[model samples]
Target: MNQGGNKIGGADSASRAKTRASGGGAPSGGSPALSIVIPAYDEAGNVGPLLEEVRREADALGRSYEIVVVNDGSRDGTDRALDELARGDARIRVIHFAANFGQTAALAAGLEAATGDVIITMDGDRQNDPSEMRRLIEKLDEGYACVSGWRRDRHDDALRSFASRIANRLISKATSLPLHDYGCTLKAYRRDALDPSQLYGEMHRFLPVYVRARGGSVAEIVVRHRPRVVGVSKYGFSRIPRVLADLALVRLLFKYRTRPSHLFAKVAGYLFATGALVGGYGVVRGLGKAPILDMPVLLAAVLGVGSLSLVGIGLCCELVMRNHFYVLGRRPWRIARTVNLPDPAATGMVSDRTAPTKAVQGHAPL
Candidate 1:
């Protein structure tokens, strides 16, 4: 549970070889049919039962599967619990973060470590029912790239539920990806539909939107929700502002990710026009014996300067965006250690599987 170092922890060589033989390692030899990713944060009591339930359900599906759990720097005994579980079950792979990174970072780590044709993501607090996983998988088999779970009857405090409803409505309208429950973590997706590098901040809730923007079809279905019985909820009203900010970021990335200069140019054009109009009015007033250094002329000058500055910023952002897409990439979090997971280098892949492009300057792999 040390948060100061980046250490690599795993099973013995024999266990790893056995895991690779059983399709529990990298996808080089042969990947599992399904990969279930759960992000746990101080969910020491719930992680064990949840994984057991998932194992039972996965066995019922009659397909090879692996469960990837991310220990997001839990202060409790969650990391030790995961280590014990992984020792017994080769299908269970664990990733430990160096510090308490948020849920989005945990999901990014889990998604990158997973090696499966289809990936399922769910909360580790046991609110999402494992028995309903089949429904999501079946829905995915119907030619949809992503299948999201909708909690029609959510079990939570009235205030939190109300806020969630409003937030979901606003997010759906903003992203143009409608879903009854964007906050629900129980979802299934094709491996190709996800780009872990695009995830930052609280963007995990907008995975369906990202998938759809990449030409993938998305679907949603009603799922069962259980009230938390073990640990306290990690979310609160404090996260509302962050969620709103992330929503605005999502909108900007979706609409103007590639050519953001167009959006800036349009705004600058309006500013320039308004400044011209104001300057013309100031000229007209001056001809009528009004003072030349009046408020109108000064306001016009400020607007003109603001417009020019915006244009410059737009050009700078364009260059940065181009560099991000073509040359450099970013990862917002770092991994501390991994258990029962293969090294990407051994599989002929870069260390940071989340980043498709080269890592940005000063963001090297741990």
Candidate 2:
């Protein structure tokens, strides 16, 4: 691999040979150096051409890399297409889920299977050009833990694009990550910078925040975005509500990831204090009045009960979080396929280290 340790492309061939000799299918001794993970759902028409284009681009970068494609229980011919592609290329690996687990789950699977110093994630649809992968990798060379791609000139229809912009803005504000295009799937991440276990729901869009929460830095770069050539967009207007709902969770994670009890306690405490004050007022007023059977007494009673219930719920959450982290040792992500190869150190974006000395030939820009 690149002796510089931070070089964008380099691999230890000797270590890889040994790994293969021992029956390991993935690069060994961290040889691949780069891993590209694509999550596909009913992308039968796109996977084959997408893989070819990805290989062309990756080869141009002159890096030893692996391409991992996750078939998210596609009801189409995606399975056969991936099978055919993998048959001809050893660097290509395909994983199939038993049922459609959504994009977040599919991406998590790919991340687990990835064995590279740097991991790259992109959409399986043809919209994200493979040639832009270099831009993201180059950004990674700049010592950032994560580099996100911003589709500056989105090619989607007007309504979809507008909705995406709103959602992206909301997420940026909620997580305090300040990313321009959280919806863009094209992003590059350093191996240690990513915590796949911290992701769930549609929170994949908050990857930069997840990494930043662990003391890592993030950056954004402009990349080409094309209209989908095949397969329908699985997302629609309905996803907006789900994403908005997830933002609350993201905010909680931002403020109290390691201390769930803090958030719950804070809420419970507020409710309890408010309820106690109101109930006390009602009691005093009722004692001085002719009768207490009115809205004020009922409201006070409801508040008191609600406050108690909130406190109890908060306590339960505290216990659950403790068990989740300490007792169960549960992870946020899972992988169905692993190459288990030792990969080389995936480096950051630094001109001195990652800039290609010679122009890569025979490659056309996508």
Candidate 3:
């Protein structure tokens, strides 16, 4: 799974096409070694050139790769252009969505169709430089499962930058991932490092945090950013509210990453200890002939109820978390097979179908 853009070559459609025409059976596992997923909204002007650049870069590195263009319900002519590109280039594949989804869904869709062991996701608007692939891929050599790109000098608007700065600060305070750029789209991830379905919302910005929650390590590398030459930025200032909400979710995830009980015990213990001190003070006043039915006594009574309320809240939260925590199943099991339950008849004890489904290919849900 040499994805941070490392050039690892293996069997791919082009090679297999030639091999089969020569009267030889396509060998098993003849998929591309890498998949570069680009999430495009209305970037018709940028898509073709970026796709070509990534293709050339992957080829130059001597790796077999597939470039998946996820045309996420753009009102522009982006889908038509992508369809044409897919028609002419065997290495290019297009996921034409009927309506505009979000970028996260677009990335998920590309991930679904991606057949490569290493998957690289980049913004199709051209801000994410293709050349940065090498740095990200090189970092993969150090045993990191995911390499998130850091844009040191982002070329976004002032409002976007301010929002990003505040979001980055919140994320840094909440999670162990110390990268300052959580919203950067130029990222490379090992296929097995993440469960495509385990993501949701504006939560995309905190993917590294989510990975670490599941026991995977992520690294970061500086990347190049360019101003958007075409297409409107799909992200807007309103996203500041969503990012803050996502920050809260990420913080909760990090706190309960391993055992869930510790989070509850710590908070509950503090509340109870505070209540005990207040109650003891009230008792001492009453015993010492100080005003027994004073404001201090009432405050102590309130404190005791507040502490009990906190303990009860903790219990309820623990139960809710338990249900979802075990839902992930017994740690890692290779999935052996996924039943979807709705499509139970689909065969293959271990179908190579994960990459073919909507979960990995859809955008934003952004």
Candidate 4:
């Protein structure tokens, strides 16, 4: 992560000085007990009021809190607005991306930068109500590693809402983590429950699923959703394909993340069995009166070749998966600059830390 932003405010300078003096632990004061992370993209008109609402709710919590906002290379004045917000408030931290790296990347950067024991994530468009934060935190306190938000009364258009319902059902069925709203970003997580390295390509929405897979308890609550009042929606029907693709990836990881060859080997076994049966029939006929180079023999040969190819591919995938477990330096997002944050190296971004593998209560390992 690069730290090369043009400095603008005295508050940011003062916070940086305090962080440096503390040796990247916490600022002059104690570390925040809560960290709210919001990812913004072209939401210049929305984030300002959103942060104000967050501040109000955070202050009401009576815990030391910091708001970490990631500017996702917005062409609008979103960067300037975030800078202005961070300029005055020492608790507001702004991370600027080199370019638009999508919401997952932005969340990854914010999670890496967050120093709180409890972290909450929400949208920047102000559709998620700040008043609902207390409900999520209370649920988190009930021995749950994750508390996801369910937008029961969604304010989106009918078509989008229907699409969201279908997507949520499909994701729930595929990942086996039944939740009403997987698309909602208004979720709270324990700092230890999140592994920022697993985030990429719209995987932010699957955080609860990932946590559950790692044996962390997850709970969902009905949250209030308001209509977008300022900026345009960043998502649309175009994201449907991407959502489906990421869902498939999630299913694959859930079932075969540790042993991918088993998945491939199962399919290959069926192909090989069918080919052998056909080849046996071909040989039986050839031994009687049929020609050796018959259609059954040719079909069997094709299936046999395909089975062998699939087995080879499975082996290659196993090797790739093994290597992935050993290498963790490849991150999906790049940072252009940061305000009121220490270097990424000191924040465990490149550390050897791994997620907890114990199973959560009432959930069996897949």
Off by over 4 Å in 4: 1-29, 269-328, 345-366
Judge candidate 1 against the unseen true structure and give its global Cα lDDT, from 0 to 1. Answer: 0.76
Give the poorly placed runs of model 2, Cα more than 4 Å off.
Answer: 1-30, 258-261, 269-366
**C-alpha lDDT of candidate 3 relative to the true structure:** 0.63
Q: What is the C-alpha lDDT profile of model 1 across 1-366, one tens digit per residue?
A: 111111111112222111112223345567787899999999999999999999999888777889999999999999999999999999999988778889998898788778887899999999999998778777676567777888878899899999999999999899877777899999988887677756666879988887777667777888889999899999889988778867866776678767767877786787778778776776766645766455666565786777667646654564454345334454555577778987533422232334543343322111
* Candidate 1 stretches greater than 4 Å from native: 1-28, 269-330, 344-366
CA-lDDT, candidates in order: 0.76, 0.69, 0.63, 0.75
TM-scores of the candidates in the order shown: 0.75, 0.71, 0.67, 0.75
Q: What's each prediction's clash count?
A: 0, 20, 17, 1
Q: Where's the lowest-lDDT run of ten residues in candidate 4?
A: 1-10
User: Model 3, stretches more than 4 Å misplaced?
Assistant: 1-28, 257-366
Of candidates 2 and 1, the better by TM-score: 1
**After aligning candidate 1 to the native by TM-score, how far in Å is the CA of 2 from where it should be?**
47
Q: In candidate 3, what are the lDDT values of residues 2-112, reduced to their tens digit?
A: 223222211122221111111222225876767888878888888888888887787765667778777777777887778777778777877665566577656755665
**lDDT (10s digit) by residue, model 2, range 1-366:** 111222211222232211112123345675587899999999999999999999999888777889988888888998888888888887898877667778886787677667787789999998999998777776666566777888888888899989888888888777767777898899988776665544556768877777776666677887888987777888889877667756766676567767878877787788778767766777766755645556566566676677667645654564455335322323333223323222211211011113322332221111
The predicted structure with the larger TM-score, 1 or 3, is 1
